[model samples]
Target: MPVSYIQGFDPQTLREIVDVRHCRERLDELGDQRSLPALLERVWLLKVTGDLDAALAVSEQSVRVARMGGPRKDLLRARVLHATVLQFRGAYAAAVQELTTCGEEAEGQGWAALAAFAYQHRGKVFYDAGDFVNARADFKRALFLRQEAGAPEPELQSTLAAIDAAERRRADVSVAG
Candidate 1:
């Protein structure tokens, strides 16, 4: 499910369908105390609501569940989403770590689109931190992967422009020095 859709789903509907309490009850009923998807959903909700600490707590839980389940795909998604949350909170170094792990996992899983998205997000984090060199490198990688995956052009174009601008600024600074 798309993150937007998941986030936009009515809380009432969630209560009826996949409430955390209900999920916990179901887990108890099933004698399996791990509800990875539900936990991830909660974390995403917390993130969208700008509750970083709550989001981080749930994200950590989701990572543990994904690890125990040995589902690389879910693990990659969780890590990438967690990294995005961290980036939004201005935790750049931690975001970089999560994104690097996500990239490695995506590469291992042969998920090109996911890898590209991770790179794009990591680049944005670097860009926000004023680390234009690393930002340009990451954005370049994202552009390559996105192009290879036949992604929409407009998105890549904007990022490419940003990278170009950053590089030009760096060049200007070097010349001025």
Candidate 2:
């Protein structure tokens, strides 16, 4: 997430807002269950609604829950999502650290889909940092993984678009200078 992304997230309608109101209600109702999906959804909505700190908190809790005998993929997914929250908050170093671990773990486990997902987010973090070269490389890897897994084309298209956008931006900067 970048400054432009935050500016363009001007949600005008209730549905568009993606607030954590309903998520909170669901959490309360499922207190004992601690539904991972619901918790992750709550974190995502909170971040979308501009509550970065709160989202981070829930994300941390999600990781903790995941570490407590949760599935490896769940833990990896939670950590990846948490890194996204960090990215939104401009904590690039932390986000990179988290994403790197998640990506490595996903790859080590041979989780092509999860590895692709991790790479996509990691690429976004690199893009946000203006490290276009690394970003493009990560996106390319993500695209390859998606293709190997037979994932939808939209995701592959998104990775390619990110690479193209970064290349264009870098080129523009070079010519301007």
Candidate 3:
């Protein structure tokens, strides 16, 4: 038998989901390793599993490690992931602030993929805060950046879905008001 796995944020719930088996396998493989890559993966697994506190700690460590010696791109990516953990923890302001800087730096560096990632996550943060306008704007920007970067189909689809969701919510809120 062949097994398949899919992991990402649910469009409706805005909650991240991971293949448990895959997550377990990866975690086991990473056991006790504190390397930057290992720490980043652990942070993602922990965050997806709702272990926000543990994820936050690991993400912070990953950022520190990335800052200490990792390449510039790695440091920016680490910061973006850390900001995501913060977003999940309801630290919207902090998440948005970090993501803004990450997006700017990525764009300045001509890293379209990284800039898209930062914008997409920032959109999620805005959505969680009920700022649908900003969310949709960010999502649209992410979509454009992703396209420019030649991102894979799934990534482009994800951004499109986010944009749709934000647009729908914004329309609903306006109608209700």
What are the RMSD figures for all models against the true structure? 8.7, 5.7, 2.9
TM-score of each: 0.65, 0.81, 0.92
Error of 3 at 79 (Å): 0.5
- Each candidate: what lDDT? 0.70, 0.76, 0.88
Error of 3 at 3 (Å): 13
Worst lDDT run of 10 residues, candidate 2, spans 7-16
Supply the global lDDT for candidate 2.
0.76
- Cα lDDT tens digits, model 2, 1-177, are 212222222211101232346545544564544678777776766777678888899999989988886899999999998999999999999998999888888889899889988888888888788787787788889889889888877567666777676677668667887
Per-residue CA lDDT of model 3 for 38-98, tens digit only, reads 8888888877767899999999999999999989999998999999999999999999999
Query: Can you tell me which runs of candidate 3 are displaced by over 4 Å?
Result: 1-8
Query: Highest lDDT, which number?
Result: 3
Shift of residue 88 alpha carbon in model 2, Å: 0.6
| TM-score of candidate 3 relative to the true fold | 0.92
Root mean square deviation (Cα) for candidate 2 = 5.7
Ranking by lDDT: 3, 2, 1
Please give me the total number of clashing residue pairs in predicted model 1.
Answer: 0
